[model samples]
Target: MVTGLTLNLFDFQEKAVMQLLDLTTDSRCKQTIVVKSPTGSGKTIILIGFVDEYLNKVNSNTAIVWLCPGKGDLEEQSRQKMMKVAPHRTTQNLFDALRNGFPSESTTFINWELVTKKGNTAIKDSERKNLYDRIAEAHRSGMDFIVIIDEEHSNNTAKAKDIIDHFSAKNIIRVSATAVENKRYEFYEIDELDVIDEGLITKALYVNEGIEDNVEITDDYEYLLDLADAKRKAIAARYQEVLPEGKVIRPLALIQFPNGQPETIRAVERKLESMGYTYDNGMVSIWMSEDKRDLPENLTENDAQPVFLLMKQAISTGWDCPRAKILVKLREGMSEQFEIQTIGRIRRMPEAKHYDDDLLDFCSVYTFDEKYKAGLLATMDKAYETRRLFLKPKCKTFTLEKEYRDLDFDGLGEREVLNRIYDALVEKYHLTSDKQRNRMILAGNGYVIGDEILGQALHGVFVRTDMVAEATSYYGTRKRVDTHKHGMQLLHSTDAIKTAIGLSTGKVKTILERLFRKGGNPKKKLLALNTAEFYAFVINNEHLLRDEFRKITSGMSQQLGLTLEPKKGVFHIPEQDFFKYDPGVKEEIEYLSNAYQEYTSGYATSLVRSISEQLFEQYCESRDDIEWVYKNGDTGQQYFSIVYLDALRHQWLFYADYIVMKKDGTVWVIETKGGESKGKDKNIDPQIENKFNAFKSYAAKHGLHWGFVRDKDNRLYINNTEFAIDMADDHWKPISLVF
Candidate 1:
């Protein structure tokens, strides 16, 4: 049997998960680690690695709890991986061990279904008892207990609560594909994305998800063929890993004819059959002769064994296959979610214990990159968002190693932030451009083509070391020849121009090309890193950024002690985060020892709270507890506010379950959980409440609103009113929050 899996995270620090894992090996880190890897990011593989370590290194008394939205999907995927695809210590050994009776109260895989039932209701009695018995007995028997929860966010109903409570272990680990704010525990992260911006998953080609509408397709069959021709090479390129050792995987043309298009399934099926593939549905075409019309009926089966399944349909959200090495999406309008799921299918670790020296096969075949280009870009947007979201919820705070003040290049000496393209053309690409530096590159792409107008020495140094491939050895470094390749644009900027000024002679060609394209002047100067971030902001997100910025400026956020979570992209800062500083704050301290609401968390406060608490103690240290006067700028009221800096961010920043306030009462006594770093943008439209709805109870809670309110006290009142009104209004139309 394989001894154990070792995840050697030596000196890698690109994304958040690395730090998270490094810290997890320690037992005191009770902080919940929310690894915000985008779909297809190999979240499962990482999890399995962690599980393998915990089971062997920790205690066998560990019982794993796996919560899934769909019981069938969960069992199928897990079983398939364990039996068919897992690499180390064969599944047969596991089955043999299990079948021979290793003891019922031993290492196990459990689903929350033990607590949930039909009708989307919960199982509160027998099921809950059975689950607890297994866990408690297992733990009592000196068995280690580990829980791996899948689709954790779906734990909304009371039944799921039964399961969560049944486990009763605070160490229950949750796994989710979406970017979620943890605010539940300390945070760590891992980013599988090569370049993180708009979304997560990346491939040979990058597509931003938001620009779906910009992508064009045509009704004419010729258009498709023409488009396919453009992407045919790339399509074949997708199959490189799967191709036999020496067999070149070339694009197999897929000609879609209206009626025949549906028949494409049969065509692919026949091809796979010839290639020795089996369908999970189990209709062995070699033996069962099903007519074309009855192909679906013939291929349908409830077989138990896993098979090499080839599905043309976009994989659904719940697919958890360890053996799924390939995914081909035939339709368009592919969302980031779809891409993430497809990527996730192949990323799961092989159940037994084999790690491929080569990364798994991930290839996408599209008629044209143009069609899904925006969606792909949109994917990056989501990935970035998901990353930040996941990290925040996990309660991660960073000091940037160095202070932003020190990191600032302010007053370093103002070099030209703008330069023209004339000198750029002559010196850079060795081409003359009548159009100056302030022009667009490649027309539509956001680049400014230019020669090394600012000169190569300085500018060349700023370019990432890996930006250009080295020239042949005999010739020395590769010439920075003019390139028409599409990529994330560097665009017009002061830093870009200044850096361009110093570009090496070899890199002039690219500098000139970029300056000329984006109407950027090369002689003036290029923009700096932060400036570039501002200028290259996504259009659809401009208003969002502006709104968030507005909230930061608004005094209410300051009054409430809420700060802008820049990394989390679009969350509007609530008033409390800005204004609710523990009165115990002092000079030189960047953050508080504990959040003001720590008093309500039930658990002891963290170090962040202690810093602020120390200051408070200076004021009223001897007193068991103390209250200070608090002001609510929005409601035009003032009242006493209690403090215990140790509270989590959510306790005060999030909405409350209920708050009781008599007309003349000074304080808003409230209950319920606080929110994490950020939540998704929710829209509002006025509506009336129903009789049975908890209108009375809801009306009693006030959560702070971003830019909409002012002061910490305002939060208690604001949160109460916001959700109350939401529950009352909101046209029975629920939001999907799909992104």
Candidate 2:
């Protein structure tokens, strides 16, 4: 845990931080890493945690350079967030770096335009040292730079690359909601669903929700603003009901105008003023490139004053106004592509949590532009109008067996991994304590060992033809390849070894030192190479070592005898669960709650079931013998699960799809999947046979009944006797007959 932090990061954020630390600390990792995290995922907090963890774990002279895009004073905003989250750490800026060389173990936030743009005072040659000079000084002082490019897509110009090159960064992490994929860098994406699951953002984004298709868009601007204002007022009322007594939140509506639309802006202003929102009062605010009005310093707070904000593209990137829940995008003559950044502004929950109120938990967008709506939906798949449903009241006494892990078990630790690697090496090479003999054996087994590492260099050229400007067909008249000795770059030879083997820098070092360090334990030390010779040997045999390590890692689980057994305990279904469904769907079941759309007898869940699961649910509800059906959640302690071992012997919990309580006082557990047919089984899941066998064992031991259910050709099949992939197998029968 990072000390001196004001806010505690969620599990997903902490996981991202650990991944960043692993990449930055490992010399074998890629030079560039892209973080494709969704907006409102607390990316800044994750990076700050990474920085603090890296500094604490590794003993090295390191500096973090956070380069923010030039918008909304994002650099300063990021700096303040860092200070608030980690006040104990030293945070500085470009000017501060100029006055003093890049401070070690500190973060320096720099606006890219300040130093990258030509003729900028910070970049100009003056009495004060420029950014380049400071970077050079930091390098001279043995600082390892880790650069973070926030909103990297916004400023991916040649100048930005040039500025980044000045730092000679060991690692460059580019962060954005819409990060582009590049083969040269490793990608780390935080699933948007995870953020929603954590309740950091709205459950869904509704566009033109509840607007009848028959309605004509004769007046696009006023109609959209009217809808937005009504929704905002409704949300404000919901906030009053859900929030604490002293805490207040006024949901603000943002009206976005396309560039060069002065008349349309005035018309919207008049419309807003008529709706009790005006500049004269404190309810309205406008933020533009040159014009600003009634804006408070802290608009993100719950009790901020502004209830309506009008903006034209200035707050698109890196703006954090959580209370702004409604967006009314008014169009001009030209059609504009709506960026996700604009919608992202309203996605964040004001209190960083959902109030379980549909009116307050969902963000709305009122836009008539088809192109803009398409663009917005293209970015977020879950953005759509949804109607709530509650759990039916008839199934109130539902109970099911839930699997829980044993707290005392700690299987497959780092020590086991290290031992397995060591054993694999010894078994493959037939190693002994005799260092000279081991060297001979290694050389004979295709392992290169010499003063210089041997590598191949290729030289070729394409032949241009008159058929095309640049010929697509290439013909190399002369193909030349020569062997060359690895140069002084061998100094970082461990980097190649670690990269090849997919291990951390420290783990690689520890393994190497244990195996080859001079004057070490005779039993463990298999190689007798000094520090210099060890590096050369590693560089020469990087690929061979990588292959061997890959084999060991892939087979590690198979070699280990680790398995999980569920404890003899069970959890029951909760009284309520939240549910959302597309409003366009006309089928409304009577069992769901009218007020909150909850199932009183179902397990706690916030998931929208898949098509197969929904169909299976409908099947269970229609059955005469079934008393009630409770859906099992995919994860968490509140859900029922069965411990199963995968083919690799790795332990995992199998959460069955539904638990059926029959009228005969018997419980039936069913796992749903697409049935196999002669045509194709595109939805088939791997390693399902293992889960079926585990479920069978669990049922027998606990005196319960279980079945594997699959849908094939509009018919449901049950396999309770034997696990088989073929639908025609003797163990399979129709679900109705089995029930």
Candidate 2 lDDT trough over 10 residues, lowest sum: 458-467
lDDT over C-alpha atoms for residue 510 of model 1: 43
Please report the candidate that would top TM-score against the real structure.
2
Off by over 4 Å in 1: 1-25, 37-45, 83-107, 111-114, 117-125, 139-144, 154-158, 180-183, 193-203, 206-314, 318-739
Off by over 4 Å in 2: 1-7, 127-129, 372-739
Candidate 1 yields a Cα-based lDDT of 0.31
lDDT of 2 by residue, 608-696 (tens): 55545665776765667767676666787777787764433435678888777787889888888877566677455565777788888
Give residue 106's lDDT in candidate 2 (0 to 100): 84
Write one digit per residue (lDDT tens) for candidate 1, span 206-227: 1111123323322212233344
